[model samples]
Target: MSPSLTCTSLSFAWPDGTAVFDGLDAAFGPGRTGLVGVNGSGKSTLLKLIAGELAPADGAVRVAGEIGYLPQNVTLDTALRVDEALGVAARRAALHAIEAGNAAEEHFETLGDDWDVEERALAALGELGLGHLGLDRSVGEVSGGESVLLRLAALLLVRPDVLLLDEPTNNLDLYARRRLYSAVAAWPGVLVVVSHDRELLDLVDQIADLRAGEITWYGGNYSAYEEAVAVEQEAAGRMVRVAEADFRKQKRELADAQVKLARRKRYGQKMWDSKREPKIVMGARKRAAQESAGKHRIMHEEKLAEARERLDEAVEAVRDDDEIRVDLPYTAVPPGRGVLTLRDLELAYGARVQGTLELHGPERVALVGRNGAGKSTLLRTIAGELTPVAGEAAAHVPLRFLPQRLDVLDGELTVAENVARFAPGAANNRIRARLARFLFRGARADQRAATLSGGERFRAALAALMLAEPAPQLLLLDEPTNNLDMASVRQLTTALESYEGALVVAGHDLPFLSSLGITRWLLMEGRELRETTPEALGKPV
Candidate 1:
């Protein structure tokens, strides 16, 4: 089958002269394709080009049919009604005019053959778990997750031939994500999604890996792609080992040849001193020896150069993914000390705590809830960023909160400077040393926070929070993995492993929460909290 989308010799560069793609070619056929890459690799830019939201500086983006795009961030005007947001307000108005016996040719034309447009719109909304939403309801009344579903519903209503979704699951809760997965599974036309959600990637027919302005296709889903990459990396590592051994052998041979030449030169000098033969014969012997030595030296040098080239090629084949190394023993909490306590707490949003509760030691707690369930409000209240309506939410030790928006970082400040603000007493050298563990080595720590990518910003924010002067005996994180790539997520997991503080993380990412070694699971539902098991939480509400 022919590809639904194709790019030929595509080239694009930002106004700042940073080139994103050059002489790049790619094709996406009629199937679901998951486009994945590390942060700053331009996955979203490629999607935009395909959707006509962006134009390439050179070459073209060819599409077989109509396109629908859902961007990473979906913003709706507060005044927009549900029907207006779905692009059916005019048709609905025309239908109402006809029903009231005031039909005009223009109204009929506006209605066209979509007499059931309203019903179809409602059905589409229902399919996306928005059945409870009224067509006349204001957009401001819906939650963030609902807005994402509403945008997707609009796209589905259009039924475009090629669908593009960039981080579609960014604000979606578990139930919303399941609805999206079903829609993706049922999609029959070309679908290309730029996302870091592993579960969403698992439903795709193939994986498109974008790196260094090039694309490489792998059959099957994310797991299969990972397996293939692992095998390839293993082979590359073996090749590197072989090349290094060959390089060492070549160097040893070169050194041995040099030593032999030096010994011969010394022996020739001794023979000349002893006057063992005629001067002409001795001189001829010396000249021949010098010529032979030159040849040997040139041959050995050539071999060594070739070996070095082989080693470089072999090394290039291996992938380089840096990991964060964090050590914060000072953040550890004593086993018997109370880290947090909640007594008859009533959140600002009216979510109530059933009874008194206490957390001690370095307990890791997972807070799971549906969207609009006040998870964020509860976390904010616990962090002292919000006030409870009726009761007390107290933290007995120094703590830090990493919210989903990552607003803890000051955009105008350098990464190291931001960390220093949080760690007032820490010396510059000490702050720089800790920042290095977060992968901001040397000059990288001096980069402005606004210039950092999503992943880099996350690391910088985490470093600031963890390396604070008070040592954060309790850490509260709200959906920390929302937009992070898989590599960044793994790095976060690694960094959290070294943290000895009490943790209460509110997130819908089950795999990530599980990896944090959570000892307790709390479910927020109907304005109350209940302790539960991971297995129980895995089930649908």
Candidate 2:
């Protein structure tokens, strides 16, 4: 098979010369590959480099043929209809033959024997649950998630030899994600997927852990990589501990030798003062002392080399663990069993349809539906951001809403500033410490909120909520895992699980909600949040 994308000593750095990853080298072959890393550890940036969307500071990203890249942020221009934009890619390719003169055989080959690109595009769109949108439906009428799906459908119809996807499953629900993975897995091309979905990662042939400008290859899928990483980490720790122990022993031995040498010299001096320095062999005795010192020096040199070797391994074994710690401080318990009550709740904006919503008690409910579904609106109504047009929405305690879009955070202030702004009465030092707990310590704590990623923004907003004098008794989250990687998602999940405050979340990711052990599900459709399942919540295809 022809070689796919190749990166020879790929090096890239920011404008300030801060290295993202340097001396990086990897080749993506014709099989599925997963790129794993923490947030800001160069996963997405590397994807961009591979797709030729971002030029590296040094080194090259070479690809075999035409590449189709689907970015995490899916954008569709309003000028073009969904079908028009998608078909345009394949259409333009076919048009190339008509514009230029070529041999008949080659020309026929360039434009596939049977001209059915439109049909192919429509079929792909159907697979992605976008068939309902007609050939002339405007992209501006589409939801964000629908736009993302359209982009993928377009990419599939283009049939590029190289496929690069960054977080394709981010906003997709369980059914949608399954559909996407199935479609991608069937593609006959080089697939390089950068994602945090464990189920998705299991489909890849190899896993590349990008950290500190290096990619360590691990055969098999993410599960296998996890096993190997565990073993390697244990071995590294052992080597480091052994080196430290040996160094300590060597230091003790060196001290003992020095003391012995010093004592021997003093004894020799005493003998000389007593006029008994080897009796008639004084010159020989002095020579013997000099030889003994030379042996001691050689021993020290040997010990020095041993110490250097140990130090080298110790340094090399150092590894980094990127952990996100969110310490949520719960407010005093409300004098009520059920915190939020929604009964036949109906919400909508103007002509948008919202079905009836019914929720009750302190149960941790997962509000799930499609992108344009009334999930966010339901959360806003619960948080008093929007009043229901009909039906009742009531809560026993103060409810804090963390919107999926994260408009709750002020983009102008630093993380610390935002936290303090939200919880003004928290002790200054306590606020700073809280910021540090959320992985925004030092300059990160002082960073402008505008520069934060989707993950950091959520963390900052959560940190502020956690520090509230009386933490909102009920925490309402709307798609909390949108931009977070797998590890970060786990971190957030762990933090939320530990929270005593009740949680009412509206999320699209089944893997995440399932992982969190969410039992209750309120599926949304139109303007209604109804009890539903994976199959019944499907968007019209």
Candidate 3:
């Protein structure tokens, strides 16, 4: 296939001299490509480089046509009108002027051939589930998910031949996500998406596994990619087992050869000491024995070396899926232990709850809601970060809240230092030993928080939260998987599996929530917080 976008010998590094990519080459042909990797594997960075958001340190990116990029973090000026944010304000104004009987050449020039720009823009917005929004409405009026859709609608209006989206579904609710999915399914150009959203990846034409600064293409969607990788890992494991057996066999053979040589030497020494044969005959026999032993030793050693090399190569072929193995006994709550309570609460941004809400024991709750529906506000209220206007929102047990932005860590501090702050009075060695479980081993634990990638930062923040001194019995996580890759998401689920606390995670990731073994589902609407199931939400658990 001919590539619509290509990178040749691309290189990039942070200002701190941490190299992300070096002499990397990638090509995206005319199809939807799901770019996947572990956190900090440079998937997002590569998208930025290809989209011209970040300048490469070396080589170049070549595109066959116009490109559109939706960044992971979409920030729009709140004061701008929807049309302006969509890059259609000028064109729309010119069209309106011409329709109002203004025959000016400047208006015609500005309008160009897109006399139906207004209609097209609105159609794009409506297609993205923003039909209620008007071109004159301010961006601040829309929710985060709506804003993302608006940006995507703008990209669609321009009709770029190559589109790059980095975590495009991060802020989207189920309704908005479905809209985005439809758009992705309909996309005809070269679409490269760096996302942890499995549902989004399922729509892609192929999967690109980015690992250690290289791209390995898989010939289908996420599921196909997963199956392919499982097969590869199985083969790699078998090779490792075979190599290990050969290595052991070589060791045994070498040891046996040494033993035989030693016995022969001793026998010859004994014969020489006795002077059983004539002096010249004994001397020649000893010389021949020494040469024979040397050659035998060299042969065994060579065979052992080859075996070891095979073992090393086989081991290197296997993938590393390091997990967060943590045990927080203190965080565990016995059954029926009251953890949190909300009574007739009135939250910030004017969301009201009329009834009492209670959380007990180690209940895992999944909070699902639309963007701007006060999920974060509810979590903040439970965490005591927001003051409720009416009734109290209280947590009886010690609680910790991890927000979407992951602002728990101090940027200036190292990972170890940050964890130390969370776990005061804990020994330095203990903190590091625990940090290793979070996959920040040795020098990685010494890395500054500011220098870490999105995944590393999330892991560091999670370590601090889970390793806090009080060992929080109630954990509130808001969109915990926002910037995390699929692997990081799995690691998070593993970590949460060991967490014996009550969890109230506010996120749109249904698969991740299902993996957590949620015991309750809470849906947040304008003024109602009700118990609902995945079926009621029209999604699988």
> Which window of 10 residues has the lowest lDDT sum in candidate 2?
350-359
Name every residue pair that clashes in candidate 1. none
Candidate that would win on lDDT: 1
Off by over 4 Å in 3: 1-3, 14-18, 266-290, 539-541
Q: What root-mean-square deviation over C-alphas does model 3 reach?
A: 2.5
Task: List model 3 lDDT by residue over 247-342, tens digit each.
Answer: 999999999999999999899999999999999999999999999999999999999999999999999989997888988898999988998988
RMSD, each candidate, Å? 2.1, 4.8, 2.5
Q: List the lowest-lDDT window of 10 residues for candidate 1.
A: 532-541
Superior by TM-score: candidate 2 or candidate 3 = 3
Runs in model 1 deviating more than 4 A are: 1-3, 266-288
lDDT of 1 by residue, 1-541 (tens): 4439889999999999999999899988899999998888999999888777888999998888888999999999989999999999999999999999986999999999999998999999999889999799999999999999999999999998899999999888878888898999999899999877888899999999898899999999998999999999999999999999999999999999999999999999999999999999999999999999999999999999999999999998887667888899999998899999999999987788878989999999999888988899999999888989988998999999999989999999999999999999999999999899999999999999999999999999999999998899999999998889888998899999999999999988777798899999999888798898988866654
Candidate 1 deviation (Cα RMSD): 2.1
Residue pairs clashing in model 2 are 21-213, 353-526, 353-527, 354-526, 354-527, 354-528, 355-527, 355-528
Q: What is the lDDT of candidate 3?
A: 0.91
Candidate 2 local accuracy as lDDT? 0.76
For each candidate, give its TM-score against the true structure.
Answer: 0.94, 0.84, 0.93
User: Least lDDT summed over 10 consecutive residues: which range in candidate 3?
Assistant: 532-541
Candidate 1 versus the native: TM-score? Answer: 0.94
lDDT of 1: 0.92
